[model samples]
Target: MSVFDSLVGQSEVVERLKSAISSAKGGSSSQKMANSWLLVGPAGSGRSNAAVAFAASLLCSESGCGKCRDCQTVLSGTHIDVERFNPTGLSIKAEEVRELIARSAWSPSVGGWRIVIIEDADRLTESAANALLRTIEEPETHTLWLLCAPTLGDVSVTIRSRCRHLQLRTPSTASIEEFLLSNTSIDSKAAAFAARVSQGHIGRARFIATNQEARSRREEVLSLAFSLTDIDSCFKAASKILDIAQNQAESENSERDSQQMKQLQDAYQGTGRSLISGGARAIKDLERGQRSSTTRSVRDNIDSALLDIATFYRDVLVIQSGGEEILNIDLRTEVNEFAKTSSPKRSIERIEALLEARMNLGRNSAPLSTLEALFCALK
Candidate 1:
């Protein structure tokens, strides 16, 4: 098995990586492999997976044979020569980038190349990007950088222009369904439902397939469309939607937060006065990071809820236009009722409202106020 086997709907990218590996091995200047790469794609389009696969292939003598030690270590994130930076907060700061640059300058210890993977390079602050730009400009002989972002425009132009860029497309519904059937125990009907509803997000499709609570939350979010009949009802719906998002975010973060706090406490136990003082500061920093992560999680969950709501309006519009293939086939009765009662123009307006709310939330606007106004407009 090749390391690229796990990536669905990215055959072209796989081929490109394979070619780069061949070039690296053959030492051909005519097809010289890139020292830095930018992998851009829609969320759930396997950008991160592609980066990891390429890293593993580059480090492996056998070119990413799945069973080899190089590939296994890289996949498990234990390889000394392959470092992955996943930002837990909203942005990657200059301090973090500086530390990474320092570590990346070290020569490869266990592999032919030192590979650094930054998962959401778009989150880099200006200072952080500038710090990183210098290294990419004068990379060490065995250093390779792989940056993943939702789009090329998300990264600074100077950095993007220097890297070999690859774009990934959303996996087709059929491809996603096939992946689920082959890799999971989900039944065909459930797999198809997950595939259709996930909007090309592989991780979301798998979660929806396996998690009862996720499905329930999606139902509750979509039900708000019918509940927004009057001013009072619209307010109630807005509160309910926010509640759903907040509850999910808190649930996802609580256990991880506790675990991290416990580990920090354990590490600081029985230390001297100076070390304990340092631990206190560390704890405060950790607390701040935790809060940032929770905030990001809540915003992401709200955005996901908004996307679900948008799908309802989308299906309604499709029905209004006499289209048969709708995303929410399970909610056909509700969709049909909505189609009959609303015009395509109204559906379009509601979708626009959803988009506006998403943008406002992204801009750090107050969630409750944004949702309240959005619900009113949606009504």
Candidate 2:
């Protein structure tokens, strides 16, 4: 298998990257071999995967022949020369960029190139971006920077202009369904359901296919359409939604938080007294970072729930308009009944309300209040 096999529905991108790899290996003065690259795509569009694959290709003797040890190490993030930066906090600070810059100056430990993959390049603060800009402008001979972001607009013009841009499109529903069925144990029906509901996100489709609890949670969210009858019911619905989102976020982050704390403690362990003079301050900083990470996780979980709610209304609108293709095919009976009582106009308005709630959350509004207002509008 090739390294690009997992990049579903992106044949053109795969071919282009393969050509670049071949050109670089041939020692040709080609534009395809760039010192820095900006990978722009929507979430779950496989930007990070593409970057990893490219890194593997650069490190591999056979140009990304997927079965090699070098390919496996790079893809699994165990390669010494491949450094990955995924911000756990709200932003990437200047200090982090400075450290990366210093690391970039080092020659590769084993491979021909030292690859730095930044998963959320858009999270860099202004100072951090400036620091990164210098490194990108005057990169080391054997250094390659691979930055992934949701869009080109997320990065400053200076950074954008200095890097070669690669764009990835969302996979088709059929492509996702096929991948789910082939790679996972899910049946065709479940695969189709997950694919349609995920709206072309491969990770989400796989999650819904493999996780029964996620499917049940989505069903419960869709069922809320039948529950929003009165003001009190709306408030209850909002509270329930927030509670579910928080629970989901905690479930996802609790184990990670515990592991991070343990690592911090182990790093600061000493023979006697404190590990360092300012051990307490160090621990406090770690805790602060954890809090920021948890806040972002909870907000992300809440936004996902809001998207589910919006998609439910979208299904309702589709049903009301006699559209046969619905995202939530498993909830067709209930959606049909809901559509019978709800007008297309009202369904459209409900979707708008959910979008507004998402926007409010993005602006750091109070989650409970934003959700309550959303459910009230739905009611």
Candidate 3:
């Protein structure tokens, strides 16, 4: 198997990267093996996977033999020649980009190319982007930069213009279902359900299929459509939604924070009085970072919940329009009930409300109030 095999439903991108790999291997220079590339794709479209595959192919003497040590190391993020920067906090700061730049300047120790992959280029602050732009403008001979973002417009024009751009489209439901069926032990029924409900996000489909808790949580979120009957119910639904999101965020943060705190303490050489006194500032900084990460995680979870609600309404719109393809197949009864009681216009309005709630959350609005207003609008 090749490294690119993991990228589902991106044949065009895989072929393009293969051609680039061929060019890198002293084949026809027609593809003009770029030193920098910007990977633009929607969430779960495998932008990072593509970047890592490309990095592995470039580093592997056999060009991405999936079993090679080079490929394994690169894929597992243990390759000395490959550096990745994926900020868990809100933004990638300038200092972080500067450190990456310094590392990128180093010659490859084990491979021909020194590759730097930034998973969320959209999260780069202005100064960070500028710091990166200078390096992209005049990159080292053996250096390669791969930046992934949700869209072309997310990154500054100056940086994007200096790099070759590639786009990865959302995979089809069939593609995602086939992937899950082949890679996972889940049955065909579960695979199809996960694929349809995920709305083309492969990671989500896999997670929902394998994780019973995630499926249960999603069910609870989607059930809000049926719960928004009265004013009291609406308010209660809002509280429930916030609690679910908070719980999801907290569940994700606890283990990661514990691991990070342990790593910090280890770096400080102990956990006694002197270590605590010397590491107080670092501990505070880590706490502040954790808070920022938790805030983002809560908003992300809430946004995901909002998307689930929107998809339910979208399914209702489909039903009202006489379409048979519904995303929420499991919730067909609830969808049909809403469709029978509400017009297409009302379903559209509810979807708009969900979208507005997502935007308000993105703007750091109060989550409870935003959710309360959202359920009221849905009602």
Candidate 4:
């Protein structure tokens, strides 16, 4: 098995990357070997993993044989020449890009090539991206830049034109299920359920399968569709959903935030006492970055809830239309009852309302009011 084995259901992409590595190793002067590459895919589609595998292939003498020390270190993110940046804050600043550009000019420390992987290239600020344009357009022969973004449009045209583009699609449910069963102690039934409900997100499927709390939370989110009876119930549901999302986000970030602040304090301990001398501005900047990260986390949680809610409605529509395969197989009975009482047109309207609510949330509308309006429409 090669390091590319983990890229489940992406055989075509695997082959393409392998061919590029072979051509480069053979000194064939193929166009497949490029200084910069852009890997575009949906979230959880394993774009970062693919990029890492490609980097390992470039560094390994045996071309990513999976057991070599070079492949292992690269995959584990300990290789000196393979630098990865995954922004925890809202955006990648220009300073960060400038530093990366400076690093790109250096020769490899221990490997055949120096690889830089940016997992969230879409979060680059305008100035940050501009700072990268020249470096990406004219990088050293032994330096390769791999950028991962959700879509091609997320990157600027100039950068996109300078790089080779590779696209990955969501893995099939069976592929995800098989991967889960092979890797974890999860039973076949639970694995199948998680795969279906995850909607092609392999990481999410594994998470839901392993964590009972996550499964329970998903059940609660799905139950909202069946509980919408009156206006008061809709409002209550909206509040409950929003509160749950916010609380989850806060809980997930609280420990990390505290640890980061502690690290900052430790770093500044022997410097000075006063705010002006001790670098209070740095703490304030950290706080601001944490706030931005928290906001993003909350929005992401709410968006996930919305997707679950939408999936429930989609199941209703599928059942009403006599479709055989519904996404929520576990909710078949409730889906059938709802389908009996609902018309196809009304179900489509509800789905449309959910989609519009998602769009509004993306546009930075007030979350509570937007969700309340959405639940009201469902009622």
Question: Pick by TM-score: which candidate is best?
Answer: 1
lDDT string, candidate 4, 156-266, tens digits: 888889999999999999999999999899999999999999988878888899999889898998899999999999999999899888888888899999999988887
The backbone clash count of each candidate, in order, is 0, 0, 0, 0
The TM-score that candidate 3 achieves is 0.94
Return the clash pairs for model 3, or none: none
| TM-score for all models, in order of appearance | 0.95, 0.93, 0.94, 0.90
- Point out where model 3 deviates above 4 Å: 270-274
In model 3, the Cα lDDT at residue 340 comes to 93
Whose lDDT is higher: candidate 1's or candidate 4's?
Answer: 1
Among the numbered candidates, top lDDT falls to 1
- Cα lDDT tens digits, model 3, 3-78, are 9988999999999999998998888766668899999998889999999999999999888899999999999999
Question: Which prediction has more favorable lDDT, 1 or 3?
Answer: 1
Q: How would you encode candidate 2's per-residue C-alpha lDDT over 1-379 as one tens digit per residue?
A: 8888789898888887887777777756655488889999888789999999999988999889988998999989899999998887768899998998899889898889999999889888899999899889878989999999989999888899999899999999899999898899989998888988887777888899999999898888777867899999999998988888888878988898889777767776743447466667877888888788788787787887888878878988998998988877777888888899979999999989988898788667998999899899998
Question: Clashing pairs in model 1?
Answer: none
Score candidate 1 by TM-score against the native.
Answer: 0.95
The 10-residue segment with the lowest total lDDT in model 1: 268-277
